[model samples]
Target: MLKRIKPGQARLGMFIEAIEGSWADHPFWRNQFRLDRAKDVERLKSSHATAVIIDTDKGVDVALPIAMTERSSPHPRENLSLKRALRTIEQSKPLITEMFENARIGGTIPVSHAAQAVEHIAACMQDSGKALIEVTRLKARDEYTFLHSIAVSGLVVHLARAVGLDEKMIRDLGMGGLLHDIGKMRVPLKVLNKSAPLNDVEMGQVRLHPSHGYQLLAKQGDVPRVVLDICLHHHERIDGSGYPNGLFDKQISIAVRITSICDVYDALTSARAYKKAWNPRDAARLMLEQEGQFDRRLLMQLFHSLRL
Candidate 1:
């Protein structure tokens, strides 16, 4: 029998359907499926996720227990348990909902206000670390962006604390991470949501977001340059393979360097439409193997930071 899990409870199980991100736009959803109840059941069975979040977007489907989907082959990020995923959804859903409401009202949740929330997200990571880690990591997929931003910011708090950074740096890192991708709001959703691979032209348009984000955040009152720099350079690479500026070592701030590593690590380990999520170990190995691409010493620090 399929398990019905409470919001806070998690478990493991097998998949039955594709969990749709609410941001996913398809004509059949409204025009075709609107009048068909039987179709929904059939579609659900075919897509067959063991547990699904009823009213959310971006990793909203909470799998029952451990979940195993049909393998396209072995993937690095495929270690999520249905239970853990659901537990994450349950634990994270309410917090994200609150953040959304607050953001809509133009209430800025400052970095200082995040301490309690950061601890809570960190605590949730001990078990069911799949969406647990990412929920704390960020959701990023519309109506979910603020929570995603907060999740990234929360990670900065935890990570900064892990490395014994001073309180000011920690706060700066969190705010920077939160606002890092704010530029994407101006980009076209077609490019953001396209299921197919983006061509070079499309990709080029997508890449302009860092500058856009920096400009957007700059207009807001008193945003620290540190945060603005993160918005600008989080895409930069150690070997200069990153976007926008393609800056090299010493050119990027320590904060950008730190946030860059964390951002990429979370993206690799989290589920996405175009790519299966990677496992932490695999993602780490890949990052490690990238060879002179990332700040090794900083990566090491970040790795050790995860132990806390």
Candidate 2:
């Protein structure tokens, strides 16, 4: 059994299964470990993690009655919301991993599975919008690619609803966001995960993902046109500065526009191997400063919708 306890409650004998925060907020390189060193416990307590998940079966357990109750006692409703959000993300992992892996190997794209994942994400957003978004923002480095798709999917749904799009279109946009970076599967891991700045060749290869993803989906023969459009054009900026075709504002559809904002916002707020995650406020502000990179009206709408 796993129990969440305050970081302060973490003792030397506990087995830390996970820490409840982004990778940038924790002091340790890995999430799971047996807390054997006194200094390590102190380090964890001083870190920005609000809670630590300990596997009670592996090491000494905290007093169950007190630890469990106190963990949820402060705000049971909020805790429940977080748990639902976590559950939704966990359910999405295998579905998404399989979907992307299949795409990488020339297998058919599972539209039904993708739609089901979108529905799960959409339902989670409706039930716990803030909690779901907050949970999506906390991505582990190794899980970044998978979690990023989930995060962008949720963000697009949220923004689409905020803009009052019809239900079908909203779901299509969700699907688009979910698979927007499918082309990245074609990029080599060495290029994708490079810690240092990329050379021109690497940068060019990275930029090809939109077209790569578009071709992958286009070959599927049954993907929605809207989804295919988003996969190809999410990178295209309003001012024709983006990749592939460098489409101008008029050529971009509203769905793609919404997706672009969400895509960039999630990317900005997510921790990458080459950069620390920017806080929401800073990320939004920086996006605003980048002239013509996104649709200003929709971007503002997104910021307002998210209350950032």
Candidate 3:
């Protein structure tokens, strides 16, 4: 027999048939497992997983007193479970990857291609905001450009909704994130793939990508202003420390602020050839410590959305 119960209701001996949150948020590599350790139980309890599915026959049956409550996430809006959201992201990656590949060859980033990918992500966000953003962190080191675009777009969708932006504005923000790093496609693979620290000249070359990407998108003549802002300014820090442009304080728009947080968070947690991946929890903490580097409210909203 299988049953669903709140994460808090789970007991020590129960078999966790499926966790209801993103895999990035949990420690387990496999979804189905027996809860044999006290720490595992505690981790699940503290996780963003609102509910967990367990096999009564495979482990201990639910305790009588705890089994009587409703079997759903505390926030019922999370109708799309983590597993389903991950599947959606996986299916959407290749479409967006092809778009990036085209851009690398002097191809224009068709708004149509971006709309299809953002539509799919918006659909996933309608299911579960947390899963849509968190699950995309699971990607190969070589896929940073392709996957990072998708990840930031998804995060923008979540942030846009959280802040009550209208549908049109939200869509524009999503499009910007999907194409934010399109300029990197113009950067030489040798510099982008270097496994060691870059010299100043190399770093200078690397920083030109935003402008290069912006110029490419601008030529398309159909890119939205919000999308253009993100492409050119996602790297621009609030304190004037970022590259391509030293736009500081009010110069950075909310769209750029939201995208930047998602952008940095994904970059930190992702496994790059140059450095090992930081744990999601550690990445969130480090971002909080960077004063004047990010918008505080949007930064808090990113963590709150991820339940980290």
Local accuracy of candidate 1 as per-residue lDDT tens digits, 1-308: 23343322222221222233343422123321111122343344444233433332322345321234333332444443323433444444455445334433445434333334444444444443444454333243443455455556655666676677887777777667766776666667788777689999989987988887776656656677898899899999888888898798789888988788778877776556577667677888899999757888878776776642
Decreasing lDDT order of the candidates? 2, 3, 1
lDDT for position 225 in model 1: 81
Worst 10 residues of 1 by lDDT: 27-36
Per-residue lDDT, model 1, residue 272, is 60
Predicted model with the maximum TM-score: 2
- Deviating ranges (above 4 Å) for candidate 1: 1-59, 63-144
In terms of lDDT, the poorest run of 10 residues in model 3 is 63-72
Query: After superposition, which runs of candidate 3 have C-alpha atoms over 4 Å from their true positions?
Result: 1-83
- Best model number under lDDT: 2
Mind sharing the TM-score for model 2?
A: 0.79
- What is the per-residue lDDT of model 3 for residues 128-236, given as tens digits with 9 covering 90 to 100? 5556554455444456677678778888888888988999999999999899998888888999989899999889888998898889888888889889899999999
| lDDT at 246, model 1 | 79
lDDT of 2 by residue, 21-96 (tens): 8778888988788865446766887799978999866665553211333453436666567557767776777789
